[model samples]
Target: MHDDHDHHHHDHHGHDHHHDNRYSDMQARVRALETVLSEKGLIDPGAIDAIVEAYETKIGPRNGAHVVAKAWTDPDFADWLKRDATAAIASLGYTGRQGEHMRALFNTPETHNLVVCTLCSCYPWSVLGLPPVWYKAPAYRSRAVIDPRGVLAEFGVTLPEEKKIRVWDSTAELRYLVIPERPEGTEGLAEEELAGLVSRDAMIGSAIAGAAS
Candidate 1:
């Protein structure tokens, strides 16, 4: 057996052009397929626009925004969110299939909370829609459980060795995300103003609130 590999291609732009052509071909094929299916009465073309509007107008971001507003207004409700996220989040009238068994982790100045499912892509999707791209990456799954501090450093978060790392292994039966410790300056802000500071990463436990960037 003989194995010989070329060092590299001379024109990288050639590969990029090929990819662009494939993408254009795919778009044309998809449009043609839709037309055929609609002509045969197998599909409703208008449904795609309706579905897009539903997500763009009605769903997503609303759930997390509601939760952040509630935490700012009610201390008792905030405590409930820390204790039982599924029930507490529901109390805010944000119940759905994605957050049925969601558990919340609280990040404090002394003890920070970070979440990563080293096994699968388990997350609190009810509040946060599509997980961030990195959330489903290979590096996160492998290093987070073993060297959390190292991974956190990339995101500018570092913890002392004396501080314990609490790793919660998740299951499809139970999903989780961290509730960030609030910032100092947000003290007298109203619920609406406070909601502006909340980010999905803050909820997922990779970061904390200090200043909005």
Candidate 2:
């Protein structure tokens, strides 16, 4: 009886170990994808570091802020962004390696947009800067698509039941940019001033761009 019980316990532990191995395998696959993309010139190693440094020290989310502000204030520019995000964003001199292919997702009173890379961390570094650490985690990669509403809630974004949530998946060939809804009570603000109200999280669809305090 003792030996049988011990064998049962060992099998249970082995099952848990197998589950952990699967998680590690997923991470390994993600790294392998990154390597393959890098070899194919889809991902630039320096570009990642540059983006991280920019966000940590200089430039930062200001690049995206400007884009968002321009879109909010200039209807023509907004149309251009919707039509050809890459060219429109490049027109403002925000072009880079991973940002070669871009699509702008506009949030409205009835719809919200969220972005995630289920396979790997494919992000538009030029405009949004380096993706947050959580964006690359397996939990986020899976949950963002499976339970986006719950994920948004964790980020302190509570959407009304009437509002629809749209989750976009990023890939090596393309990436998404969430154009947050403009805040209220700032109708007379200048473009630069409007830019100040935009935040990185807001652009990520994890938070809303509230009225600038």
Candidate 3:
């Protein structure tokens, strides 16, 4: 079953919006500091933009997406994905901090899992490109562990209460999401199509891997 997701929306409830943690404000501050250096003839602001663009585009998600695509197609590869995510992923030419301490948790029809950071939102920057806005929501932080199923239902996912839920505390240094085995009926599909069914939480373990219709 393809789990419903509302990626179009960004939940703002319980946001840590004290202007102290705003992304824009953070960007502005960095820009401001750079401008000061430029005025003093110490740096070139032009260089930062190019560097940021390369990382955001040329390096990040492409690596993670490729790993996911490969795992979906190879059974032995999936084992590599779980046992030692970094080396397993590095074998494909992708490596580094975002995946440095990578841990892959495989979900199944009989088991379901979800990832959350009660202290803070830690994510796989290499594959995900960037964390979704809702991934850092205060509502998500407070409620996910206490009411995993209810939160997932909001996104059109409903799991049986009999299944025990495990919520991993994400930290600044470790943890990664790799979703579980894909359901049947997806046997003939290509990697690109299969990727679409991987909801953000599917990889994190909240829902089972869905076969696209």
Candidate 4:
């Protein structure tokens, strides 16, 4: 069983520096506003940063890692994931805003999947927590579609020259999660143990699963 996917990469050339600057400006403004709020004792920047940090590194990605682990160990769940990701994922109690719709892209020896929100940072926050700043950057959004191989290289995921790359465009209504192939010599690991191999970048398609270990 398989889902429909895009195989051809776009031929667009050049980065949109203007768009990048605009995104950077927005971030700067947010930081400035946070500074003002902190100065007035209206908000605790440290607490806000801690919450964001937890989502970025701990809670959100751990949920996704569990899902990936289950898929690795249970064929039935994997099938469910491929057929109806939203239902299968929600069944695991990961439902939330920006995560109501989901798609799972299975990677293989011959093909790799990469996801990007070219228009804006449409990410699966329920599963992934906070989207990485790079994911929202204009350079990544545009280059991931135009030169996926190069983007992967920058992420240190250098696939074989013959391996195909597929780019998925995530939207506000739909989001994607990459199910990286299970690593070698992990045949006997339990689901929880397997989950340890999954990483935020791996699910985002920027790196290979198990690479972190």
Candidate number achieving the greatest lDDT relative to the actual structure? 4
| Pairs in steric clash, model 3 | 113-205
- For TM-score, candidate 1 versus 3, the one ahead is 3
TM-score of every candidate? 0.70, 0.73, 0.72, 0.74
Residue 201 in candidate 2 has what lDDT? 81
- Superposed on all Cα atoms, the candidates' RMSDs to the truth, in angstroms, are 8.9, 11.5, 10.4, 14.0
In candidate 4, what residue range of length 10 has the lowest lDDT sum?
1-10
Per-residue lDDT over 85-190 for candidate 4, one digit per residue giving the tens place of the 0 to 100 score: 9999999988855435899999999999999999899988878888889999999999999999999999888999999999999988899999999999999999
Most accurate candidate by TM-score? 4
Rank list by lDDT: 4, 2, 1, 3
Residues 52-156, candidate 2, lDDT per residue (tens digit)?
A: 576677655789999999999999999999999999999998886743599999999999999999989998787887888998999999999999999998888
Tens digit of lDDT per residue, candidate 3, span 135-193?
78999888988988888787666777776667777787776775656767888988887
Q: How well is each residue in 123-208 modelled by candidate 1, as lDDT tens digits?
A: 66667776778989988877888888887778776667777656666667787756666777777988877777777666666765
Displacement of the residue 111 alpha carbon in candidate 2, Å = 0.5
Off by over 4 Å in 1: 1-62
Q: Give the TM-score of candidate 4.
A: 0.74
Number of backbone collisions per candidate:
0, 0, 1, 0
**Which ten contiguous residues of candidate 1 have the minimum total lDDT?**
1-10
